[model samples]
Target chain A: MTTTVCGRCKSSGAVTDHQGRQDGAVVWTILRCPTCNFSWRDSEPARAIDPAARSVDFAVDADDLQRYPKILQQ
Target chain B: MNDLPNRARSISSLRDFLELLEDSGQAITWSDPVMPEPGVRNIAVAASRDANGAPAIVFDNITGYPGKRLAVGVHGSWDNIALLLGRPKGTTIRELFFEIAGRWGDQEAQISFVPEAQAPVHECRLEQDINLYDVLPVYRINEYDGGFYIGKASVASRDPLDPDNFGKQNVGIYRLQIQGPDSFTLMTIPSHDMGRQIMAAEREGVPLKIAVMLGNHPGLAVFAATPIGYEESEYSYASAMMGAPIRLTKSGNGIDILADSEIVIEAELQLGERELEGPFGEFPGSYSGVRKAPIFKVTAVSHRRDPIFENIYIGRGWTEHDTLIGLHTSAPIYAQLRQSFPEVTAVNALYQHGLTGIISVKNRMAGFAKTVALRALSTPHGVMYLKNLIMVDADVDPFDLNQVMWALSTRTRADDIIVLPNMPAVPIDPSAVIPGKGHRLIIDATSYLPPDPVGEAHLVTPPTGDEIDALSKRIREMQLGALS
Candidate 1:
């Protein structure tokens, strides 16, 4: 039961795997715009990095435009 | 007279800001042989320290753009702010925000009308079937950027549905994706105030007409894009910031346009249901994925005499987005916290891909630390991406990462920090459910030293600026002597 299409291409098109990884974690994140059918990914950005630190961590859930609600921490 | 942004006065028609890159006494021009083909184009927005310890950016001569005015530093530095305010930039951000957010005694927009004269945007006007690729300087910044997005573009539009809301033209700075001839979409973040307004208009079946302001003084563009209170308008705020009303005119369809705007792209947002907006480099030095956002449809275009289009490179700390949006928003947050935490020092809207924020605070008491943290996290801004919050003593400048790290190393501890994991999270964040929301941690690193040792911070930090400058001078002199 595939609920959502492949996020990168946005065509409901998908292969088994993909590319672009950071620190062995899947670096490229694919998402499909529900309305426009335009598909894109959260890929590696290009502005200068600190040189020391390779990348900043992106909370997979921190994706909502507004305060995408997180489960309150105790 | 001031014409387009970053452009020299009195030019012919529209040009890209990249044409104006001045040689920094270098041997040869670095960027050449690279035309803005589909993949080889990139604009580097760099922030380095000026003589006065303020930040300045350099727009390196882009490869493909020859004789185009390059936008070096549009986020006007402190000195530039002083020029804008007509007062000293020595006034701290706290003071600036408090003055702006606070009620100025009997302050109002006093209009000085110019009957279509003295305005610079009237240099050349192209109506209908306008091909943006030819007239203005549009760079294909990166290979993956959907296409050449006019990096810096703001919309001046009146609500199409409501005639009364005509005067409410928002200078919405959005990444303009050039779709085709006479077609584009304002790919701004959906949560921006302008986005919400467009959505509301669309709900009632209204077209969002906008006249964009690209490449102006950093003060106008950055401050205008700031999302203040729901009722607050950026134009008015910019006017107040400039110590004068931002002079504007009525463009087509009731849009209040900036008469002094460098480049004015008159257009309307489709305000249709939605479209995928990103994959563009975000300020946090990461690719922000696609989200359903309102796309704009261009109608007409206008500009100052030979206007220079400004572009901001997102994806890192010093990018134009950080200099423009980050500090602009941080000012108000500092103002709001002042009401509760009066002694609050500074708030650093650190761009960790729109994630973390590190604030420097003046500790009033033991419990005051956490209170400051809670107040900051709860402040009404789109701070959903704030993950790491640091509280330092007022002595430390929050803008200085070194000082922040020093506070963390010397004063903060694991036990003294407040961590809220799994809090309201945004999806784009790899750690959150949504990209705009997330867990927040407050690291209270304010010094808790013994009272006696705290007597007047001795020239304690040593003359960092002077020593470094002297050493660099010595090295340069030594090289000169050797050559001689």
Candidate 2:
């Protein structure tokens, strides 16, 4: 498992996966930051890895328009 | 007696504010060719968000209109507003509101009237064949919006019958929809000054003459958005803030307009003329359902030789429209609250698309917080659309949502919440029981009991001040990575 740092609060280990889905060649995920209570979306290239392989964490979320919430409720 | 420095008072015009932003490296100019659809609004929103409201955007080479430019996000952020108010870079929105409230009752400043020949807005007058859609590229931000919306329009009107209010015109910023080239629909609530003026004009058997000015100084827009007394002039307030007289020219119909404005649409609202107005995206980040509104018939259109069309992005939180409306309501309401409770420090009406108001005050008495909260709901500005009013201690910054939420969680109790039903309603609220009636809530988040015997303990610990300064400097030094 990889640990991600939140971009807003800059706190590590405070992010959790809200949802994840596989879309053809990419794996899309929505991550929520508990420190700032903000959510962002991310995507990674789909690949197969051994159970013992080390996972790389990303410092920022993926900037994809499709992954953004269509209606941002206030 | 002027207490503040001259530069800290007010800005001259919208162009002057843009120039100041460019000089301070707070504005970005886009020269690349782009279409009005999807491209202009997309880049404006992205640039504003990326900069965290630090930069205003100007699109110079729009696809169809080669020389004509469009500017947005000029007043989109707290930093830009602080700069415009001549405050420090890190000034909070609450602090700005306090300043405006402190200066709210200052004597009116003098304004100069210039002839039409001297006004830049009258450089090109189109009395015939005034095609608005062809002249300016009014882009649509939302896919479901009814049509092109003049989101930042400053509409001017006056009371024709009241002799005491002679020459005191109310300039308000309301959502205007372009129904046709020669006609428009204005969303004016009955409680607003403009609505009252319209009703007064109708009673006197005269059509309410109105003038909508666009692309003036940001200061003028701010003054117009504010709900000052009906007997006051928004132009005079703007002039006082600027520390200089604002130049104005009479329109063809005799209504005064900003001489430095980019465009002016002179129109009159005929009695008994109503049309379908909305379904346009409002500041609440939602589309206000369509409703019947008074239609404005355009009499004449005037503009500069090459004018820059201005628009404020709507349909979301943290947009320019919210900032404008929030500040306008907060400042005047704060002034009113201070009249009875001088301990009030700051107010944040920009909370939750301005439907919620968070006011912080230095509580000297036990029930002072409740008094302030109730007074906030009774003000003319507050009674209109402020549905949720919360009061907190002076230590809390109302503009910071995190602090406000902390206060709500720690200081508020369910038993202490005051619920008043069947109050005057906000027409745009989707949850209103009827057209003009709704419930009001007041949350007294301030501490009621005395301090602990020894001392109250601080629960949460933030980073040290020095550490925060070092982190900020390090982040400033690092180059931003490219985004996809």
Candidate 3:
């Protein structure tokens, strides 16, 4: 399995899956981080899918997910 | 003034409205190959930023996405909003606000239920091998968005406690982030109608079914984002606004949706499941921090042939979200306030979902303006979002920022500013010290009455007559002649 790192939180457990097709050829791959639940497309810009290039305003820390408030308590 | 027939009211679907916009020179179709990422978003941002008339942009050629279409900036400008309201392109914001306010509770317009075989949205159904990325022209709305979002769809849900009541059914617009092929997360606060229903279902340990309708009639979108009472139906209001019956059909989840919607995804919210949702650029011109939100599992997806995916840019003040929701927000507040206090002249809650409101009222007595402001704060939508309110005299036009500023400068006294602490607030407000609670401010900008200290002040009144109107018309004609 090819290792994938999340772009927003830099988690190493991110999974990549082929999405959509053009002429029976895969057009893009979607990368999703289970830790932070951030998803990005391989076809997106570097700023959107690269941790080092992503905006600081939107950067996520996987550890912060524990402290994030639940909008509705289950 | 050019008096044209109100053709917008007859529009049945997003494509029908797009055709109307194209005929009215309010929309443009780009046939060139455009990248899905920054290219479509960048063009949409430019169109949204155009304070001048910006046309709805339809991109027919997206690289890698064959036979797909995406529409943006459908409600991005005042001119486009005017056209959506069946008015002339140059209709003033105040006129639009009052036009919507005038039809506040007129539910005379009917809704017609159609069979699935007759519904255009059911022309194609995908129940097996559901992949949202393959189905939709999914693209990031902002550079830092967590993922592709369905930001403009009308989400229909019924109250879990009163499922059979049609009036208790709700159609709203909430941001949905795609997480997997058939899974996504929806963010909503408890204050929202959908949020309340979700909370109820979670407490009862029952799955809440929903129908997400995309590319609907323009009027349906307007009402979806509107703040109406829980018992009121968005379809009724949308039909009233359109001056025609809305076509409807039941989804697989048994939720009523617009029959002419380009696409409908039937889903069920997992009762106890929560997932990381946001950190997306919100309407407040700031990124909403990540939060745990409800997860939805899609059961079926239905669409028309070659469906057009509709999306809205919702980053800052002047995007499609503000233009799409501004009049709806203002009209409800104005109607609610007017019902209690007819002295209330107008309400301008067009900024940041009524976080800050400017109200024009006829001051009955010394503290009448304050009373109106207080009542405004208690209005259904105002209770949660009306953080700062400015009260002005009836003579001051609430829609005109220049006149409002002049009133603020001249009529406001230092002691007239009242701040109430620890009030409920919209969670997305960046300035809130606590996420969902903040202080409420009221600036009484009305002139002091007899009981209060009245300093010697003489306000200038502008000259108004038919001669000035004629001269103004002549000057406009001369300016056009000069341009020619």
Candidate 4:
């Protein structure tokens, strides 16, 4: 898999929990990219996930792959 | 570090100031990794906004630039500013205005010109070729800024005809954006003293040599930002305020730079040179739209060993820019008003980098507040940017925005509010219909105590000092959590 690049700064320093999530899915979590200090909360899924039981990687939402096409490259 | 106490030595240099800060528990060093650009600014903004107005931050570990450091939030709080001004703790804003005014009329203190061999700024000099970005991490504060900006710059230049106001130097704090390896644009209003000096040099077909000093004593920064009259030297005023002569070193360009500056960039501002310069966040909480500005060609870059770059967070209210402009400009405005209205006690230029001035007056005569408002509007300095003048009784604390608003709400009337239309405005004011034209509002918030047995004085009752202190003590002793 190609490394993800932050769309803003165009730096390869972009790291996403979804990159390590076993089940690739999008949820409400912080998406920080590039140079700007802004981090947006992904829209909530139709059903709320058990936040307590969710693993650490749950912060990475796979939906970013489609929403931000440049977030990940093959 | 020098062995002398900062105040005792007269704070002749920036390093002296750093030592002073360290001694007074006003400085904090961050050895952890901090990225340039947004990262440093992010931490600075957060730290400045701390409840107690946290100490100035020094980032020792700049991620890409090893051994290079950056400092910010030096003037982040009133306490810090008071400390630099040599004022006692809990110095009221009114006292600050008086402090500046009381020292303003003193004899122009001396400035010592140190030999080049003794100047630390030239310890490590690069004259032939230098890239500013390579030498220092020019961090970008705003996300959409045109480029990295030198927010804390003291660009010194001499009037081609008159080097000083009868012997005082002219130094100004203007924004400079790094355009190339050795090129930067100076964004200043054409009418400003610095801009006028450049134009004068240009008309003479002579390049204006400017010595841009960075990371100097906070006193120097205040002096640079002050509108110390066209004929007066800001350096003398700084020396007088600091109670000591400032040390200066002549740069390669023959311009005087602060002897103890962390870094000095000597540049030649060419005649008739213009470049697109802004779209950067300004003190007005708005982006100063891009326009043609003077371009400066770098001639030399010099600095002390292990220099620390300093920058200001310029945006909205209560930033270093606001605090400096407020404290620095208030005294002049007070002096200007006191000439006409002696009843004027103090002036607080607050909110939006001194766009508004709250003048507290004792109101010895009828309608004196309105007269003060008129005088302030006509004064040269206040005429430019003071769009609103709120006149309150001396009982009200102009620095306390709440008290000011209460006076306006209780004692003011719509009829009492005077509006002057089509006045000159600061170029950076976003609400201006044009760059330098706008309207002004003069709100007379003073109580109308008519003479000849008309009515009794209105009483404003609040918590007594003893009661307030007891309550504060009780609250302090309480074990409240969360919202406490």
Per-candidate TM-score against the hidden true structure: 0.69, 0.78, 0.96, 0.81
DockQ each: 0.05, 0.01, 0.66, 0.02
Residue lDDT tens for model 2, B449-476? 5542322336576764557766765665
Tens digits of per-residue lDDT for model 4 on B1-484? 2333257337766667767777778788989876564578788778767523457888877655667778888777765676677764345565666677787677557788889878998999998867786576556666545456899899888778666433445788999987656778888765578877777777777667788999986788987787767777777777877677788888888887788899999998866756545557888888776555677899999999989898888775557676666778888888878888888888887567568889999987556788888888777677687898899999888877998998988888788888899988987899998877999999889887655233536685776455775676466557444346
Question: In model 2, what is chain B's TM-score?
Answer: 0.89
> Tens digit of lDDT per residue, candidate 3, span B42-67?
89988888743789999888877888
The DockQ for candidate 3, computed on C-alphas, is 0.66
**Residue B46 local lDDT, model 2:** 71
User: Which 10 consecutive residues of model 1 chain B have the lowest summed lDDT?
Assistant: B20-29
Model 2: CAPRI class: incorrect
* Candidate 4 wrongly placed segments (more than 4 Å): A1-74, B1-9, B88-90, B163-168, B451-457, B460-484
Tens digit per residue, CA lDDT, model 1, B283-314: 55556564455566666666765455666555
As for candidate 2, its clashing pairs are B13-B217, B14-B217
Candidate 1: docking tier: incorrect
Model 1 residue B190 lDDT score: 46
Residue B307 miss distance in model 4 (angstroms): 1.2
Q: List each model's interface RMSD.
A: 13.4, 18.2, 1.8, 17.7
Docking class of 3: medium
In model 2, the Cα lDDT at residue B94 comes to: 55
- TM-score of candidate 4 relative to the true fold: 0.81
